[model samples]
Target: MEISQYSAEQIATLQAKLEKKLGPEYISTRPGPGGGPKLTYAEGWKIINLANEVFGFNGWSSSITNLTIDFIDVHGENPPRYNVGVHCITRITLRDGAYHEDIGYGTAENVKQKAAAIDKCKKEAVTDALKRTLRSFGNLLGNCLYDKTYTEQVKNIKLPPVRSSTLLLDVL
Candidate 1:
């Protein structure tokens, strides 16, 4: 996927926002495991935590029980081709036993694709947990993202606390 060239103005805007939200510890484009420009996995998790808080992705017990990041060798050279980019594999398990293992890339296109799957997992976990946790025990199955049928059930939900997994499956 092609990285978009950011305008100077856009960079400035993003810088301002990052500075405000990230305080002094934020570092952009640090060296990743695959030698790409990105934060260390641990650092990236901190950013993820912040986003979850900001977006109120605060429901259900969801954890990345397993995560693996590696470089896919495209050519069979002696040392092998590496860092063409990285693959981030996440095995997410929800409290209600609804889970999925999703594959994503740091690239723009794949990131967008993975994000939708991630959001779906979030919605499924939350809705399922609510049913299990609530007194009335209602069915909340439907597509997320403004699907009208599940609106009432979703509206009555109170987002639960979030806990992240520490099971790192990093590979070289």
Candidate 2:
């Protein structure tokens, strides 16, 4: 459905839902290297699922607006390991044509093949950019995580559980 089909009430409802704080349960923490502050994040798959839940599959879309290999390094000649760095800018657009864009960087180190490193770097860059772009939509899409003052103690209203499709599950 187009943005025109979304009645004001529907738009208001979606806005309310998007404004809600993200649930703490959706976050995951990993210990940083060298005992630094733990790194916290919502996984890529979870981010995608949240987008589907809040926006309806047809309500929003994303595109990699720009992508390029920032650098590539190949180590020792025989069966060289390749290290590649990629950069991407992703744009997320609602059916209304409102959009947000964000940049992301991805690096692949110690990859056995040049092609493999390039592939991994590109995918990672796109996913990173997509996640960064989507965060602008609201906390449920993970904007809260970026806020230094955000507290996990604060609760988010419970949203009904959603059943994800088998295809999406398998593909992810």
Candidate 3:
């Protein structure tokens, strides 16, 4: 959506705040499949907290517009094992009417229960899509992790935590 609806000064100030480097405290690394390189990211809750920090708790919202099973494979008959994959698209809308959307995928492998696998994959997919869509906002939302150089420079720089009570007061 067009940010033109917002005043230039308002947009610039918001953009600058969002563009600031995300402190390393919000970042985490997890082991990747096949013992490959570790995956670095901010947890889903961190993204939600960052949104509240930058946009105000009531300033933005996200919705899952689409969700579907990308693939399902069931095999091994004894207890029945299955693999599932899910895809979802999420939209993030600012109170001002500007918006962004992105798709995310999740997979559950070798699970013994189909229903549980689907549930797990769906939640994972939606969370991934929410984070991906929100990342469009700016670096604090995760856009910087995509930039290896910038990430390398600030990867270890941690900032003090943003207390939710302080944020709530700001909303008042």
| Highest lDDT against the true fold, candidate | 3
lDDT of 1 by residue, 1-172 (tens): 4233455675466334433323223222345567874331113344445434432254223343333333333444553333223334344333333345444444222222444444444444433333222211111111121234333344445555544553465676
lDDT ranking, high to low: 3, 2, 1
Runs of candidate 2 with Cα error greater than 4 angstroms are 1-5, 151-172
Candidate 3 Cα outliers beyond 4 Å, as residue runs: 1-5, 156-172
What is each predicted model's overall lDDT from 0 to 1?
0.35, 0.84, 0.89
Candidate 3 lDDT tens digits, 1-172: 5646668887888999998867788788788889998777889999999999888899899998999999999989999998999999999999888899999998998999999999999999999999999999999899888988776766567677888876765545
Q: Write the per-residue lDDT of candidate 2 for residues 99-153, one digit (tens) a residue.
A: 9999988999988988989999999999989889998988789888887556434
The estimated TM-scores of all candidates read 0.22, 0.81, 0.85
Q: Give the total clashing residue pairs for model 1.
A: 1
The C-alpha stretches of model 1 lying farther than 4 A from their native spots are 1-20, 28-42, 57-172
Q: Note the residue pairs that clash in candidate 3.
A: none
TM-score of 3: 0.85
The better-scoring model by TM-score among 2 and 3 is: 3
**Candidate 2 TM-score over all chains jointly:** 0.81
